[model samples]
Target: MLFKNIVTIAASAAIASAEDVYLTVKSDDSSINGNVLGFPHEGAGLNYFFLGTGSATAFTYDESAKEISYPFAGSYTQFFTVFDNFVAFSVASANTEITFEDNVLALNGSTSNFYACKDTNDPYSYSTRSYELMWYASDAPSGCLPLTLVNSGSAAASSSALPSSTSASSAAPSASTYEGSAVKYAPAGAAALLAGAAAALI
Candidate 1:
């Protein structure tokens, strides 16, 4: 029974390390509609990929309130490997405003990498849009980590097989694949749990 309890405690530590930040989106332009993809590590020479699709539930643009809201799916990640790009979207228009809770971090008038542009070969889409790339910076929260490193041979092998697309329904990498390469961070309560487990054993 003690052995089972110890194993459970270890599993709990792993789960705690995974964190998530919620974002609420809004834009003055009502016509703007589409999906968001983001590469967390800006330094990595990587292409942006779709993160979340546009829909009434996932993305609701309210012209009256000038806001857009997204359903909380483990859609956004605390871990970078869940997807590439911090947050990129192929919305119908260029200007956007992103919020975390009540804090307005990026605004429609403001154009940072948040509005950075890259040429798109998507036969179905056009126009440059704003994206939020979170990294450790003066303005950004310090609780950030660099892009995950994988064996070059492994990343190239994987990338070559998986063609990038702006499909609205793009899914995150499977758990087996991501967890294999994902860098797990210690969650807030992880240390306390580990200490408690050790004490119980003693």
Candidate 2:
């Protein structure tokens, strides 16, 4: 009976801790390299939202639940769409190889790594189409252009934009208007229960 009770208590604690993990992603790469959106063609300006240091974007996920919520601005040209800068991901567990379609992203050490992928069909189709993807570990060929990493805004702000862009060639999006800094795994009542149980043990 004692062993079963201990297991139950341990499981509860694990659940509580796992519910508190979240991620904050802001636009960091804004250079003239392959990493920047629309590279080798027209520069989206220095402070461009997608390529330049424009705004901060954030994503929150619950490891235990596998639930993710992200917000970003959509393209300026597409007035009807919103949240255009959203990216899709496939992650099973922590420390496991996580894969994101189109772009590459991983929590490398302390800094989160991200790679921008160009559209499948290029407008100009330059001789070396490898520069479409930007980042150090980009899957692009060896001769492809390299991306230059830079710092973005300190905090993300909410904009009334949407995620709709299929490729980097589209005009960069505006920041999302939903400003959520953190994520919660459990409800307010769950925290209360955990606190009460911890106090009883004390």
What digit string (tens of lDDT, one per residue) describes model 2 on residues 57-83? Answer: 333433443343322212111111111
Q: Per-residue alpha-carbon lDDT of model 1 for 1-202, expressed as tens digits? A: 9999999997776556422332322233222122223221111221233222221112333333333332212232222221222343321232344332233333332222232222322221221233233322234333222221111212112232233332221122211112111111112222332243232122
The lDDT, on a scale of 0 to 1, for candidate 2 is: 0.28
Question: So what's the TM-score on candidate 2?
Answer: 0.30
- Clash counts for all predictions: 12, 15
**Which regions of candidate 1 are displaced past 4 Å?**
1-3, 16-24, 31-35, 38-47, 50-113, 116-202
